[model samples]
Target chain A: MFNIFKLAARNLRRYKRRTLLTSILITLGVVAVLLFVSVSGSFKAMMIGQITDSMLGHLQVHSRGYLSSIDSLPLHLNMKGEQVVRVKEILDGNDAVEAYSMRIRLGAMFSNFTETTNVRLNAVDPEQEMQTVPMLADRIIKGKKEGLLAKGEILVPELIARGMKVKIGDTIVLVATNKHGSVNGQPFVVRGILEGISGPGGRDGFIHTDDALALLRIEGREISEIAIRLNEMEQMHEVFDELKGQLESSRNKMDKPVFEVHTWEELSPFFNIARMIDLMTLFIKIMLVAIVLVSIMNVMVMAVYERINEIGTIAAIGTGPGKILSLFVAEGFLLGLFGTLIGVVISLITIAGMNAAQISFDFGRQKGLLLSPTIASGEVIVIAGIVIAIAVLGSLQPAWKAAGMDPITALRHV
Target chain B: MTLVTAKGLEKTYIAGDITVRAIRGVDFTIEPASFVCFIGPSGSGKSTLLNMIGCLDPPTSGFLEVAGKDVTHLGAKESARFRGDHIGFIFQDFNLIPVLTVFENIEYPLQMVQNWPALKRKQRVNELLEAVAMKDQGGKFPNQISGGQKQRVAVARALVTNASLVLADEPTANLDTETANRIISLMKQMRDEFGTTFIFSTHDHRVVKSAEKIFTLEDGKLQQQGNGDNHV
Candidate 1:
């Protein structure tokens, strides 16, 4: 076996120019795939971090019918006092849960003395909200990140603030209708202006929970939803499943499920775009396969054709057909192996260079966000294995043909 | 004992309704440790006969045996194994693999066909290189050597597996008169030392004079048999 590999290597070296060209082509294909996978993977991960950490909070729980009418911020679908207590109990018992924020979502009318417009608002406790969605303070473009929002204070969306010509420390009036057909108004100081994200919750403002309850005339601890953070982001599904199973069994007077748990993927529209990135990565991998197949097959076929007399001499001297087949296949395998090694090394160096340069780009209203590209070792191994396997497959036909050649006829070939 | 026996051998090739008979029915037997030659003009089936005897080509019809084994109808794998075990071949063009050193070229049959251990294979290859008078040139490639040296390397490669019968098809056709004589002397010496049978085909009268026995063929049929120095 070692002799066969040595002979295969020598044969590849016999045609230096052809071997180099084929190797370069395969190397380029590998480099293209690895680089794309790393860069696009980094982009997707960073964007997901921004969305989940700033707004979605990894997972969310709501009253059974709340999400269906979430856009309208329906007060009638809010979880009552006892239901909220049951949901908290379930969340608090799960070791995976790191923190959670209870929120009251409602639609209100915002006025800056001259202009009035509809605005969606989330009422939260500043400390709990910060723990559940830590990046929330990072999105505060114009005010303090420490306090988030105090009682009687609100964080206005940048779009709404700019449109109403309002700024931090300015007083604004919010008018809202309660579920009982009563209307109330409250004036609050603006604490901050928030940068908008790209999807569903982009235009919502924030306020303190105490202020929200007072203005809505709520008598008890009713809440619209619970946003949850986990000890590890990867544990989102496990915790979500456990909580969902437990909450599904909790029932109201009608004996229907009282709560629905959702991961950030289910709640955000950006996941579709993430899936698109994955699909594109798959297509790139397929293209890499095609490139390896054609290039290695072409080189092996030519090698067989050019070495007919040598093959005949070996075969006539009693070298078996299997040995001949393995010789050619080994050449193809070596080609893939060399190319993949070089490509992976170059890709790693390039990724390191990018990180050193601190390449940054803007996504939506987030500016100068650092892009860190990285590839897992397992991914590198899988890609390399694919290339080498494809190369072996590519050379099989030509190698078989070489092995099965009639020695008498092949010897006569000039 | 007879090392090779072929009775009523025949070979035919077909091409889209046309038939060509390269070798017709023939009968012969070769003894162990004999130096034999098959002589014929062009298109006289000398090579076809050698190919059949070497198991490189199957005869269309005949009783053909090598080393007391009937090889008239062996499968591809069986034929390859049989050839590796009992027969060696040297081609007219000194068809040494260009990519290998002379030492590696000789080691090929042992390593690839017989799966010999590396240390023993190296020792045997060195022995053959010395016997071929190419011991010092073992590290050189085929193209780096002379035509005679290349043929010597081919000779060493053929006998490396210790095959009992070595067949050379027009072995000296490409060499000059002096080199041809030297190669023939080398083969006879190898046969004397190893007790291996040598069979070759040649049109050269000089090579014919050295053979102990000769069989002459014409139009794919055996026409005459004679001892060395006897005219056709």
Candidate 2:
């Protein structure tokens, strides 16, 4: 068997140009698909990272009814007191949850005591929210990112600051209605100017949890939701599943589901765009298969055609039909093997070169999105296997024809 | 012993609506370890007779035997096995496998057909290379050798498996007269050494001159059989 494969290998050396061209065709296909899968996969992953790591915090825990009317900022539907502690127990008990932060999101009117505009406001625990979304501080263009807003202080978005003529250290008043439907107002100092975000609901204001509770006249321990960050994005669903099972399993003192769980993919609308990129990668792979199938099959047929006399000679020398078939099939398999091997080596170099080159693109509010092509070992193995399998499939017809040839006729084929 | 026996052998071809008779009923017998030649003009069924005798093609309507085994009805696989075991073929064009070196081509038949052990195969190939005076050219490819040298390699390849009957179809048609005579002399020596019977389908009189016995065919019919240029 080894001798046959070696013999088959030498056959390629007989037609250097044909073998090289065919190998190049298959190599191009493998390289193209591998690189496309890796680079597009990286782009998709990076975009999801922007939403999950920087904005959405991977998973969110909130009341089932809150997300439905979250646009209305219904303060009455927030998690509070013992229920918050219960959710914390569920979260803290699980190792997948790296961190969780509580936020009280509300709609409020922002004014310089003269010019007034509606703004979405999030009242957050300074330390926890800052840790959960570290990029938020990174986007603070005009103030220190080390600490969150202090009591009687707020972080104003540049959009609103420029519109209302507010700057760092300026005093501003926020007026809002509480869960009781009563109106209230409070004075606060602008501690920082945040760079404006790009997606929906990106322009917002951040204030201390105590300031929000005081302004809303809430003496109780009610909050909007718990935002969770996990250690790894690849394991996002596994963590989400574990979190879901524990929270949904909470049969209250009476058998009622208290909290709903969601991964960033569910909560962020930008996730749909990421899914489309993955689907595009799938299409590119199919295209590679077509290119390899056509080229490899084409080359095998020509091989059989050119070697008709050799086939006849071997047959007359008592080589069985099965051996003849195997001979041609081995040729195709070798073609795929060499092509895939070269393609993978070249693709690895290409990917490393790409990373070293540090190609960049701007997507939404994020700049310099790195184009890193990442391939798992399993993916390379599978790609090489598929290309070789296709090579064999493409050779089947021609090999069969070669094996079925009548020696007398083939001997005369010139 | 009778190494080949054929009685009423026939072959026909269908071309569109017409049936062409390539060979009419023919009868002949050859003895073991003899150098025999079948000589005739073109279309005289010389190759057709050799093809039938070598198990390359089945007889259309007759009983034929080679090495005392009936080959008139052998199937494709069985015929190939039988040919590998008992028959060797030398084509006019010296049909050597171009990819293989001279030694590899000679060793190929043993590997593919007889399943000879490597040491035995190597021994036989080396002996034939010595016998053919191609010992030093074993590493060269067929294209690297001269026409006569290529024919010598083909002869070595054919006999490497130790077939009982070696069939040479117009083996000397491509060489010059002197080269053809030399190749015929080489075959006579191989027969003396290996004691393998040889049958030739040839148009050249030089090959006939070297044969101990010659059969002449005309229009697919046996016209003469003689020993040492004497026919009844």
Candidate 3:
């Protein structure tokens, strides 16, 4: 085996240009597969990180009617103010719950001068919301926490703030629709500019807890949802089970009657679509690998045909058929092996350079999205294994032909 | 003892609709260390008979034995291994592996049949190169060498395994008279020194003159066997 291997290696060197070209082709194919797989993986990781950490906590508890609302009503979870406190306490006791908070989501309109736009407003506690969603603090571009706590003060999304022409310290009219379909209007002062959530359709505006209650004329109303942030995204089910067990054992009638659970995966279907896209990207990668396999097979066929006489000579000189087969197949395997290594190195370098350049693309719907590159070691191993398999499979027919050749005819073939 | 003995050996090849009989009911023997030649015109089956004796092809029927092994019914790979271990061939056109240098080409059979150490392989290759008077040209590829020099290297390559028989098919048909004499003299000298039997096919009377025993082949049958001067 070793002798034939050395001979095979030497033979490859004889056709230096052809071997190098095949190696380069294999490298390019491998890089394409690795690059697509890695970038899709990175995109998935980034999107999940954003959702689980900054927007929807690991899970949320909402009222059944509130989830599918046809009529505009305050279908709150109907947990009393004390019940909200108790639920938060129960969640905070669990090890999986990194933090917990409550929010009152309402639909309202913000008006400044002559402009008015409908906004989904979230009224949250400053202290607990900071623990559940750290981006809340990161979004505070101006003003202090003291000012955000002042009644009748609000912070607005950058897009809505820009359109409303309402800066810090400017007063805007807030109109809230009550459960009876009547509107109540109140004046509110903008406290700060919020940033970081950049899509065109994220929630538009946010007001403080006391100010939103006054505008809606619901001073004694219960909170609508309980949001829990788990330390690990994978722990959502475990924590939900724990929460359910706690609620069941407690004498909490309201918590049992109206609450429903949701993880971040359910709240946003974008995560699911992102996962599906990742699978599709892998499929495309497999197709490219198949093309590489075919190219290698073609090269092997040419090589076997060209070396027919030589194969016969070697066989006539007492080399075993199995050894000859190993030799030819080893040539193919080495081709794939060399090609894959080159491809991996090229891909890593290219991806690194592209990432260093910070290249961004205007993907229309996902404008200003940056193309990020990433590949874990495990993914590299899988790609290498796949390319090797393709190379061996591609060489099978030609190697068998070389092995089965008749020595006399081959020697006489000129 | 006779190194090769055959009786009623027959061989037929099918080419499309034409079934060509290259050898028919032939009985022959080649003694050890003898310079033997099979002389005939084209289509006389000299090469075909050589192929059968060298174990490159199987005889169609009847008893055929070389070095005491019956090869009439041997399988393809078995015949190949048998030929590689026991026989060396010198074709009219020198069939040196073109990609390999002369030294590597000579070392090929040794590497195939024997698990010799690198030192042993190097020593054997150099010794054969010296015997062929190609010591200085061992590094040259077959294409880079002259026709005569390539045949010298081919001789060295074939004899490197120390096989008991060397079959040369039209070995001198491509060479000038002087070069052919030199090649025939080299084969005779190698046979004398190593006790290697020489069985070659040739039409040149000059090649036949150098052989101690000669066989006249016509229409795929052995017609005559005599001493060197009988044809002359």
RMSD values, in order shown: 1.8, 3.1, 4.8
- Chain A vs. native, model 3, TM-score: 0.80
Best by DockQ: 1
Predictions' DockQ, in order: 0.84, 0.71, 0.47
Question: Comparing 1 and 3 by DockQ, which wins?
Answer: 1
Q: List the residue pairs that clash in candidate 1.
A: none
Residue pair clashes in candidate 2: none
Give me the TM-scores for chain A across all models, comma-separated. Answer: 0.95, 0.91, 0.80
Tens-place lDDT per residue, model 3, A251-324, is: 53565444566777767766677879777977877786787678778888988888877876777666767777
State every prediction's TM-score relative to the real structure.
0.96, 0.90, 0.81
Best by lDDT: 1
Candidate that beats the other on DockQ, 1 or 2, i.e. the better one: 1
Output the lDDT of residue A329, model 1. Answer: 95
List model 2 lDDT by residue over A1-414, tens digit each: 666787889998899999999999999999999998888878877666655655668789987678888789899888879888888888788777788889899999999988999989889987888767767786677776778678898989888898899988889899999989899999999889887655544677899999889988988788887888877767888887887887887655667777888877777777788788778877887887888789888998999999999899999989989889888889999999999999999999999999999898887766776788788889999999999999888888999999999998899898
What is residue A112's positional error in candidate 1, in angstroms?
2.8
Error of 3 at A216 (Å): 8.4
